[model samples]
Target: MSLLALTAFAAAATASVPVHSVALDHRGGTYKVDYRAAVETRARTIGMSAGTRPSTQRCIMTATVSVDRIIADGGHELHARVPGEKTFTRNLPGDCRGRAEQLTALVEDRQPAIGAHLAAAAASDRQHALAAIDAAHNLASN
Candidate 1:
């Protein structure tokens, strides 16, 4: 049936990609880019085979402050928050102030949405893997 085929395709697509891995090619900040790269690396290590990360452990995500010359021509106020911390304030230098602020704003805006997606996907994968292990253990014991 067409419905069955569609369902199969959907599952395959979902399996092929990590659920919350970000694809932000356009909004690359020097700091945000490096931060995102690390998250992407960790995302790849997850899934059915790679196994779940330990529950208690946590890691910092990095974001740097840098300006793009084109955007920096018109200076703007900047504010940004890194992951799991209160918003940090900065007094940027005059030359790249506009660019730096723009980058920070983009990073702060994108970080939460992306972080949420990654967290949810990672958790779902973790629970699914745990359930599979439990089922396998019971089957083996029987």
Candidate 2:
């Protein structure tokens, strides 16, 4: 192949793919207290059987929110991710299944609360953006 043709082919093959960058605009806000109640309710609803001998378990719930800025449209996009972990012990195999079910129920019941919290946080972020815009406008007008 000709040198020029080979060089052209190599360049085309090596051309970098367009990459997009994402930024998260997070805001701090308080979540509704009812979420905790829902979680407790779920736990009770999935309660263990009689003489099941109460067992101690540890669980952690982690939630994350991400917001995307659309430069062209001048709008923000919000997203949420909820993750949880659990550790427990049970005597019978059936009890183990019940415990698993309880955990799942707990997570399911709290989903609404998690979503509410994310929405609240996103609203807070929008408030921040508005405040910034107002500040800039005020400065520009002065």
Candidate 3:
């Protein structure tokens, strides 16, 4: 490959954002949570609901959680991909940074309770909720 092409490829590879970690609490009956994943600048593949199509040019994250038997027979896993573009030419805008900070805070506030529940629940029941919560929390914090 040409030197210029190699440099461009390296830059693009390095440009991809990385996911961060955050904490969570799940004492409340609410299992649904939201958080930001690593940022990305290029089109990417993301898993979606059975009937939905994967997205492109977006931020993607995964989630695994156990629902109440009443709500879902077993456990479920999910991947959430938000559609958007990221520009690194300058410092992130105040609004965007604020939103990111808020998400981090939410994860920090919620992880523990969820983790505790996962540790205490039956293996089968625990798998669904714990996996989902862990995936969601990991993505959000990332």
Candidate 3, 19-55: lDDT as tens digits: 3222333544344332223322222223333436543
Task: State the C-alpha lDDT per candidate.
Answer: 0.30, 0.33, 0.34
Q: Model 2 Cα displacement at 139 (Å)?
A: 22
On a 0 to 100 scale, what is the lDDT of residue 10 in model 2?
31
Name every residue pair that clashes in candidate 1. Answer: 31-64
For residues 44-136, write the lDDT of model 1, one tens digit per residue.
011122246533322222233221111111232112222332222323322221232333343455455545544544434443333433454
Best by lDDT: 3
The TM-score obtained by model 1 is: 0.22
Estimate, for each residue in 64-128, the C-alpha lDDT of model 2 and write its tens digit: 22223221113322222223322222222232213444444434444555455544544455544
Task: Give the CA lDDT, 0 to 100, for residue 41 in model 2.
Answer: 15
Clashes of each: 1, 0, 19
Q: Which whole-number lDDT from 0 to 100 does residue 137 have in model 1?
A: 45
Q: After superposition, how far is residue 11 of candidate 3 from its true place, in Å?
A: 8.6
